[model samples]
Every structure is written in C-alpha cells, then in structure tokens.
Target: MEPAANVLDLNQLRRSCSSCALYELCLPAGIGVDDLDRLDATVKDKRALDRGDMLYREGDPFEALYVVRSGALKTFVQNEAGDVQILGFHLPGEILGFDALATNLHVSQAEALERSSICELPYAKLQQVTSEVPALHRQLMRVISREVVEEHRHLVMMGRQQAQEQLASFLRSLADRYQRLHRDGSALNLPMSRYDIANYLGLVVETVSRLFSRMEEMGVLQVNRKSVRILRPELLAALCRSDAAPRRKDAG
Candidate 1:
C-alpha cells in the first residue's frame, strides 16, 4: 500500500523547470533534463502576490529577473507630478526587469494585475550559469531582443496606426500572448481594465470602448465585459498591417 503524499509546504519543494507549462516558450528549445535541472537551480522561489502587490518599485535596485508563472502584471511610470502611465501588460512566459538591466535601477514599477506568482532568477547567478550554459546566454539575448522589437513596434503603432486599427492590433496582441501561454486565443481574460488599456494605447477610455463597439459592429471583434473574442481574426490582422507607414513630423 502506498502512503499519502505530503500536501503541506509544497511551495518549498524543489521546483522542476521542465514541469512548467512555459518551459518550451521561455527556456531554450531542445535542452536536455540536465540543463533544465541546472536552470531550475538558478530560480530560488515562487513568490505569490495579491492584486496590486508591487513586484518592484521605480528606482528599486535591480537584483533578479522575474518570470510570470501565473496571472498577469502591469508596468507603469510616474511623471514629476505623480501621475502614472500604464506601460505594458505582462503575461505568463514573459520576463520582467529588462528595463532595469542597463542601469541596474528600475525606471518604472511592476505590479500584479491579479493574484499572481513569479519565479525569481538572481542576475549574478544567472550570469554565472550562462557561462556554464551558452544556450542560455543566447536565449537571454533573444528574450531581450523581443522586448526591444515590441517597443519599437509600439512607437510605430502610436505614430501611424489609426485609432480603430491600433485597438485591433492591441486586441490581436493580447490574443497572441494568451495563445502563446497555452490559453484560449478565441476568448480573452482581460485582467487590466479599459482605463489601463487606454493608457497604454494613448487613447481615452471612452474612445477605447467606442472602438471595441465599432469593431464588434463591423464583425471584426466582440467584447463581453472583460472577455474579448476576435470574430474575424483575419480581417483584424489585415487592419493591423493596413496602417500607413510612420512619417516623421517636422518641428516648426
């Protein structure tokens, strides 16, 4: 007869990165179990957070790379007058702390949008591990490069894409992210509210809502409360690529 499994203190058990759902997405492809074990050793704990709990604050000294294990998070920046601007929504399989990598100081704050858990990878330890595993070094560079490319894409979106087109692209992006995390892409769970979406998209809340309604009416997208479904993903995708090329405005 088998004994009952220990249920208490499961969080303290040795975590296997190979068992993680995001293993394929975040970690290097085709790495063996030994590599996975070594990578797992770099992460210390899976920290749980409540909604609105801060992962890190602006000006906090950078220490480790944070990977979203579950739920969602948002990064924001504050102006001199203390007004906050939503920067981006981060999902599982995504890494935070890239913005702080160069300066060793965070210029923005990351907060949980819902009940969340994250794996902590200490930077110094990661650097040492990378020396032992060259694949990880390349994987790290690829992850950082994706962030840079996304930022440049956003600059282009805000500069050239029309309001409706921008909203469509944003919805598509959310769908893609959720899909990549092994979630249902047809329907979305928007943890952040419309105001946060508007703030990120450079649009007002009313405009953002109106655009969603317009897209639904056009049979391109559908929204039910916080759940959005792309009715015609192909058409929506077309709209995203149909935007005019960004043009530089001359300072008069």
Candidate 2:
C-alpha cells in the first residue's frame, strides 16, 4: 500500500499566534488575543534582502529587533585592524539586533547570507506591548539572556576545548538549533560557509575541514559540502561535554 497523502494547507497561518505556524518558536505561547492583535499591528514582516547585503552595519542607529521570516543571516564585526569576526547565524524564528538596547547604537553588522526576509519588531512599539503583556516582557528578557549565554559558551570553548571538541560542539549546536526551528535534527543545511564556522569556533578553515573528515571516519557525522548529517548524534553531543573529547593523534 502507498503512504497516506500529506494534507495540510500552508497558507492559512497568520502573522499572529492564533494562526501562525511558528507560534511555539516565534512567540511565547499562551498570549491572549488582545496581545496577539497588538503584535500583529506592530510587526513589519517580509522585508527582503539579497545575499551580501548588509541589513544593518555597525554604528547604525538601532530601531528594531529583527526576526528571520525566511532564509538566513549572519551577524559579524570587523576589528580595528579590519579583520572580520563572525558572531552568530540567525535562522527563521530567531531574534537578533539587541546590541543597541542600552547604548542606542549598533556594535556589529548583520548581513544576509542568502536571499532572505525578516520581520521587524520596532523597539519603541515592542516596549509598549511588553508593558501590556507581562509574559511577553519576560519572553523578551529570556531571548536577550540566551544571546548572552551563547557568547559565554563560545568563550569557554575557545579557551579550553581542542579543535575536534570545538567542531563537535559547533555541529551539535547547529543541529539543535535547527531542531528547535522544526527542521530535521539528523540532517540539515548549514547556511554559513566553513570560514564563518571556523571564525566562530576559533579554528582555522583547514582544521575545521579535517575535523569533519575525522568525525565521518569515526561515524559521528557525514558532510556533503554545506549539508551535515549527524550519523552518531549521541557521540557528537558527548563531545560537547567537558573532558569527553575523543582521543586522537591530531586532537591538538
């Protein structure tokens, strides 16, 4: 017998929680209709940009926290000597642009890694909605807090982890984030290039390439250019824990 036909309308979802498919990931669940309506009125969605476009550069006056509606973006910055550092990658349902929350000026730049569109939550209006909805206010705080934790996690990895451990952590992170976005946890697309991954993980590009190859040999991962399949997710995740790194000759 043939498999049952998949039947689901993709167009029925609205920008707000009642009908939005990303309700669980994009917005805090259980917000009342009034709050949802307020959010729908304030959100500016579907703003598009091409690859290589800078969505917002450093020093630009900050206005809103942008959410990926489709496609992908990269947040990075240049040092005084003009070398670029990749900060993070944002996928659909991810919120970014909090750099200016306190000082009112952007410190890093956000650029499109592919043809992308984002929904802007104007900060001024977001502040108002948060005031009305206590849950939403707490939700915003949680988002900002996660970004802070991610920074600290990277610092720890860079300071103590070996190259394989760092790369393993990186792959596991990507797979986990994609899982949160409702994509397959076992196999997914890596929107950013190896260079970006290397910068974020504090490894050289060649070392990153070699790590992927070795992981495949160990049955931990399978890589085909930009796509990575986690063949041994448990082992890969274990590599993320302190001191659990697999012993290998080139682990240095």
Candidate 3:
C-alpha cells in the first residue's frame, strides 16, 4: 500500500513554525502542534527595512514585538541636545521592543543598521493566543526575564572604568551570541557603525578606534572596517577580566 494522502507537505511545513530557524530559541521546547499553530497565527509576514530605516520612534504607541528575521537593528534615544545614545544592537533571531511593554509607549527608537527584515507579532493577538497556550505564556515570561537579566548585565559592563575591558566585553558578548546561533564565533560582521558602538560603550569614537587598533597589534583580533576576526579568544577573555589599562610601547 502507498503512503497515506494525509501525509505532511514539505512546502506547507516550511511556512510554519516547524521550519523557522529560530524555532528553538523563540518558542517553548516540546510545544504541541496546536499551540504552535496558534502562536504562528500571531506572527505577521516579514517586513523589510532599509539601512537607516526607523522601525519605531521613541513615543510610538506600543503595539507589537518584532523578531529580527535578518540583518541587524539598533535602539537609541536622543537627549534634548540631540545627542544620541545607543541602547543596544539587535541581531537575527532576537526579539526586540520589550522596553515598551511597561508604559505602552516606546522609550527608544529602533532603526535598521543595515538592510533587514523582521517578523511582527501584534501585542493584542499575541496575548490572546498566549493566554490560551500555557506553554507559550511560560516561554514569553522566560524571554522577558532574559531581557531583564541582559539589561542588568549591560549596566554593569558600562560601570567598568577601563575602556579596554569594556571593548573586550563587548566583543566577547557578540562572539558568544554568534556561537549561540551556531555560527562562527571567531568571525563577526558588525552591522552597526563605529560611532554607534562608541556611543553604546560610553567611549569616544577616537578611543574605540585606538582600542581596535591596539587589539589588532596585540594579535587579539583582526579588524577590517566592519569585519572582525577574533584571533585569540583566550587573550580577549583575559582582557575582559583585566583591570589594567592597555600599555603603549611609546610610554617608555
């Protein structure tokens, strides 16, 4: 006898949660098919953005959460003087816009650092589905908790006085995130500009440039514009923990 006609269709599966690359990271483990279907229904089609495109500006009404489907985005806030402070850089497979959940108004602007695409989940629809899906509700809570933990970590990183340690930590964190995506941790293609990075790290652009050059000289990393290759992971890790400032050969 031939296989049943009710067999699964590859094309149909590709359009659902089963084929999403972020399925494991974005959804609950061992979720039932019915729950997955309901959750999937909340996700709108992927929306594309160009470099410098603003996804949502500060004070925009909170209506949806976005999952980075490709490329990168940066969230930032500008003071009255119009000086922009970058809050964070987002990568593919990561969810963003959680900051607005508390006040129902965005506190920062989200802009595409490069050409990007994202999947939007309307907050109302997401709530409706998640309420009916216990596992999904639990997963959403876990995601929110993880975001809080990461924000705290960023605050701690910013408090470190040494620029060397700050830069090192930033690189290490990026590498770790890449590793989690099952990609090459040693290599990174940064989507944000040096200015944005300096702003986010609370360092001057000149300082960030000098640090990158110094790290390259030390064989800790190789940098070419936005592309970086971490040559010595151990050395980078050491820098993250080191309290001493980088020494210059001309200091003698």
**lDDT of model 3, residue 116:** 93
Q: How close is candidate 2 to the true structure, as a TM-score?
A: 0.90
- Candidate 1: RMSD to truth: 4.7
Instruction: Give me the candidate number with maximum TM-score.
Output: 3
Best by lDDT: 3
**Residue-level lDDT tens digits of model 3 in 86-160:** 889998878899989989999999999999989899999999998898888999899899778878878988888
Model 1 stretches with alpha carbons more than 4 Å out: 1-14, 242-252
TM-score to native of every candidate shown: 0.89, 0.90, 0.91
Q: Is candidate 1 or candidate 3 better by lDDT?
A: 3
The order of the candidates by TM-score, greatest first, is 3, 2, 1
Off by over 4 Å in 3: 1-15, 244-252
**In each prediction, how many residue pairs overlap at the backbone (N, C-alpha, C within less than 3 A)?**
0, 0, 0
Write candidate 2's Cα lDDT for 20-104 as tens digits. 5556776777888788889887787657899989889899998998888788999999989999988888888788899888889
Name the 10 consecutive residues with the lowest summed lDDT in model 3: 243-252
